[model samples]
Each structure stands twice: as structure tokens, then as C-alpha cells.
Target: MKEIVILGAGYAGLSALHVLQKSSADIHITLVDRNDYHYESTALHEVAAGTQSGEKISYPIMDVVNPKKTTFLQKTVEKINADEQSVLLTDGQSLNYDYLIVGLGFQSETFGIPGADVNALEMVDVKTAAKVYEHIEAQLKEYKTSKDEASLRIVVCGAGFTGIELVGSLVENTKHFAEIAGVKPEQIEIYNVEAADKILPMFSDKLGQYAINHFKKWGVKLMTGKMIKEVRPNEVVYQNGKDGDLESLHAKTIIWTTGVSGNKIVGESGFEERRGRVMVKPNLTDPTYDNVYILGDVAAVMDPASNRPYPTTAQIALKMGHYAGKDILNQMSGKASTPFSFKSLGSVASIGNTHALGLVGKAEMTAYPASVMKKVIADRSLLKTGGLKEVFAKGRFDFYH
Candidate 1:
């Protein structure tokens, strides 16, 4: 049997593994990851806020792949020798493959902002969630004992989905948390800073405004069109359009959700691009080699309609992985392939627990109904990735109920 070696056990990697099992591709498959299980990146903000447990966002990768055809290797990929058609694992083991799939996801892009890397806590994965959880616990402790008002300020950087959801949960949970901690609501303040003029600019203008209003009602402050010039342990300095002078805000906790670049390996592998994305042909293979395929955040898949690369999202990655698997099997069997086409089902960025905004087809919804639809889509993805039984066994569908 031929070999299909996939890197990074993310949406794309896991999806490809599933298709191979269902098709009985009989391809000797080895799935590699640095972590023991897959972390749900989409719902991470809620994880950080303590609304959802960390385990809710992770799944055993082995459960999703057939052991007969697929094997999971827990190790970091040190490097790739594309010229030699081999991959070097961190433990000094090397494997050569007939076909390689790169689905390495993304890393946080600090955008060269000062003090971002060292000071602010980032909400990335389970580990990061734990870190944020610690910070929140520390804040609550300080508020309970400390006489200083300075310890109650929380700075949330970015108005994107992650930032919004994190702050939203902080708003909801912190209120309950404050009662438990015996701190007044006025004592805790949350501020969301955005470089862009608006929040969730990817969504419609109306939805963006709704988010802003809801955040205000929830007691989250807004700082728009401002560039954070500096970030210190106790202060965040920014410059707004109206005043050339810098505006400084004092905060004890700073959570960064500005954005992310592609995974490190994407560029390190000698595939050229910033943020770790490489543009590939319609079949999703590298330009220089037919044996290598890149998907997920690592691939700069072109959107024919917009003539831009597809945003790195779970929906596109899942579909891209399926298509890439079919394409690779065709190549191995000496069969022609239909070019990879992107079918954008839709997009929904959730706000806190019960509010969301998105566009699916020509229709859009706001508030509770939109949020319920988002949960439906999430449950369906879980079902497809795992199975109806697995999805039901976990019973996450009850999140909406």
C-alpha cells in the first residue's frame, strides 16, 4: 500500500484521515501532532472565561481515525526535506512518503506591537486558556483583598470574534464571579480596543453595531480607531485619530486576541509567504512537488469569486481536506482530478453564549435565533468529524438548550 503522511492534527488533517478510512484508501497513514489531543480553537474564548470546561474543547485524535489504516504519532516535526521527499520529526526519526499533507494551522501575529509577547495573555489553545483562567482568578483574588482600585481593570485587545466573546463571557461570568468574590460591578471594568474603525468588520455594519451596543450594555468599554503604541504591565498606551496625543489606560490584566499569522512551519518549510500560507494550484499541491499538499491555514487557497485567498476557517479547511484526499488518491491511481473548488457554506462569529451574527445564503439573523443556528452548525460539524453516536455520547448539543 502507498503512504499518506499528514502533518498537524487539526481540522484539515483529521478530516483527511476520516475520508481515507471511509474510502478504504488502504493508504498507510501516519498523523503527526505536537499535542496529545485536538483543541477546539473556535470556542476557545468561552473556555478562557470558564463558561465551558477545557475538556469540552478537546478530543482524542485517535478516536476519530481507524487504527487499522491510520496511526497517530505524538511528536513535533523538526523540519521537512521536501527535496528528499522526507519529514524529520523532533525525536530524530525521519519518514519518507509518497504523498505529504501539510495542515499546520496558525500562530499569533503580534503585528510587532510593543510589550505584546511578554506581558499580555493570549487565548490560543488549552494551555493558553489555562493561563487566562489563572489571570482571571488572580484578578478576582486581588479585587477581594486589595484596597487599590487599579487591580480591577481588564484590557481586552481587539474587537474581533475572539476578543468580543472573551469580553462577553467576562462580562456575564464576572458579574456572577463578582458576587462570589464580593466585589461591586463598578470595581471591574473591561475595555475592548480595536485598530480597525469597527468591530467584526467581516460581518455586516448592522451586526457590528449590535455587538457594540450589547458590549456597552454588558459594561464593556470601546476604544476604536486606536493603535496601541505601547503595552506595559500596568498600562496600555494608544493613539486615536482625533488626538495625536497618546491615550493611556491603566489595567492589571491584558488579553490579546488581535489576530494570527500562519503556522511557523509554513514559511520555514521554504514555501514562501508571510503568516505561513502558501498559494497552491487547484489540486492543492505545492508548485514544486506533486507529492505534497497543503491545506488549512497553511494554504492560501484562492477564492475565485473574490479573487482573494479564503479566510482560514474550519468549514473551508474541512472541505479542502476532503478534496485533497480524493485528489491524492486519484493521483496515486493515475486518475485525473477535478480542481479544488471552495463552497463557502456561510460564516458565523458567536458573541458570548446566546447571541451571534452571520450571513448564510441571502438571509441573516441577529440575537438568539442566529446564536441557535450557530450552535446547530457546530453540532453538525462535530457529528461529521466524529459520528452521530460520538456526538450524542458527548451531548454538547445541550449547550444551546
Candidate 2:
């Protein structure tokens, strides 16, 4: 039997596994990941804000994969030998594969910022989000006892999707946190510092303006066109572009949501990578290694319309995974695989539990209606991956909460 090995069980890898398992029984499939569970990466911001528990955002890998067809190996991938068609594991085992899928996800990009790497807290994964949540709670407790204003001050770096989502969640949880800590809600200081001239640069200006207004009404301090110079333990130093003056905020919590790059393993494996992403052919296969497929954050696929690489998001990754599986099956059947194409349904960003901003097709929405749409999208994702059972168990049904 041919050995088909899939590395990393993120959205892309898991989606590929689902498709491949039902496609053919001629090959043996092995799914490898460091963790036994598949994390709902899109909801990591909620995890960091204590709005959702880690358990709520993740499910066992076995729950979604059929053991009869797929062998699940929980281990770390040490290295990939593309020429040899082998993958070395940290447990000192090397596995050979007839077909390989690389879906190893993203890593935080610090851009060589001073003290940002070591000092700022990251919201990249479940573990880091949990840490941030715990730290926030601890600081609240400390502030309650000592009344230290610095303990309540939080400076969030970046004004993009993740950063905005996190700040929105923080806004939602502030009242609860204040109640628990026996402090006034006004005691909490949340500042969103962005180096760009405006937030959500990827979205339309009208949508961006709506978010800005919502934040202003919600008491989130927006510091635009400010470059973060350094992140200290008790303070964040930044330079304002308007005045060219250095300013500082007394913040004990600095959450860095600035940027992300493809997994380093792509470049380390001797593949041609731009920004750590392997440029894949139209069929989502590596140019040098036809049997090797890269998807999600690790694969750089260009958009035909824009003539630029598509942004790495859960939505795009899901579609890529679906296409990658079909292409692999076609290759195995001695048929030419079709080029991958993506149709974007839309995009939505939740401001809080009760509010959101979205652009679906040409239609734009805000507040409660947008919030409902956000929940619908999340529920639909769970339905796609894990079916009705998983949806009932882990789906977001509380649209208003």
C-alpha cells in the first residue's frame, strides 16, 4: 500500500484528511500532529480574553478522523527530507511517504522590534492564549489588592483583524473582570496602538470608520500612526508620527498581534520560500517535488485577479484544503489535476458579543445583525469539519452572548 503522510492537523491538514479518507481505499493514510486535539484557531482571541475556554475552542483529533482509515500519530516533526521522501520525527523515527502534505501553521512576526519578541505576550495558539488570559486575571487580582493603575493598563499592538478582535473581546469582558476584581470598569485602560495611519487597512474605508466609531464609543483608546519603539515590562514606548514625539504608556500587559509568517520548516526543508511560504503550483503541489503538497499558511498561492498572493486566513485555508485533497486524488488516478480557484463568500469581524462589522459580497452590516452573521460563519465552519455532532458540541450557538 502507498503511504500518504499528512503533517500537522490544523484546518488545512484535517480538511485534507477528511477528503482523502473517503476518496480511495488503495492507500494507507497517516496524520501526524504534536497535539492530539485540533484547535479552532479563528476563535483564539476569545480564548485569550477569557470569553471562551480552551476546551471550548478545541476537540480531539480522533473525534473527526476515522481510525479505520487514518492512523493518527501524535508527535513532533523534526525535519523533512524532500529528496528522500522521508520525514524525521523528534522521537528518532523516520517515516517514508509516497505523498506528503505540509500544513504546519504560522508563527508570530516581531519584525525585529526591540524587546517585542521577549516581552510582549502573543496570542498565536491555545497555550499562549491561556497564558494571556491567566496573566490578565492575575493582574486584575493584583490591582484589586494594591490599587496599582499600571496593572490594569493593557497595550495591544497592531490594528489588524486579530488585534481588533482581541480588543473587542477585552471590551466585552471588562465589566465582568471589574465586577470580579471589585474595581470600577473605568479603572481598566485598553489602548490599541497601530503603526499604520488607520486601522483595518485591508477593508474599505467606510467599514474601518465604523469600527473606529464603535471603539471610540466603547472607550478603547486608538493610537494610530504610532510606531512601537520598545515593549518594557511595565511600559510601552512609542513614537507618534503626527508630532514625531516619543510617548509612553504605563501598561503591565502588552499583547502583540502585529504580524505572522509561514512556518519556518518550509524554508528549512530546502524549498523555495518567500516570507517563509512555499510557492506552490496551480495544483497546490511544490514545483520541485510533485508529490509534496503545501496548504494553509505555508503555501503561497497567487490570486489571478490581483496578481498577488491570497491572504492566509481560516476561510482560504479551508478552501485550499478541499482543493488539495481533490488534486491529490486526481494525481493518484493518473489524471491531470485542475488548477485551484477560490470564491470568497465574504468576511466578518466581531466587535464584541453584541456588535460586529462585516462585508458580505457588496452588502455591509454592523452591530447586532453583523454579530449574528459572525456566529453563523463560525457555526458553519464547525459543521463543515466535524458534522452535526461536533457542531452541537463545539459550535457557537450563543450569538447574542
lDDT of 2 by residue, 251-277 (tens): 878999998999888888889997779
Error of 2 at 377 (Å): 1.0
lDDT of 1: 0.81
User: Model 1 segments beyond 4 Å from truth?
Assistant: 399-401
What is the lDDT, from 0 to 100, of the residue 98 in candidate 2?
Answer: 93
Q: Could you tell me the lDDT of residue 26 within candidate 1? A: 56
After superposing candidate 2 on the true structure, give the runs of residues whose Cα lies further than 4 Å from its correct spot: none
Report clashes for each candidate as comma-separated counts: 1, 0
The residue pairs that clash in candidate 2, if any, are none
lDDT of 1 by residue, 290-346 (tens): 889989888888888888888889888888888888888898778998999877777
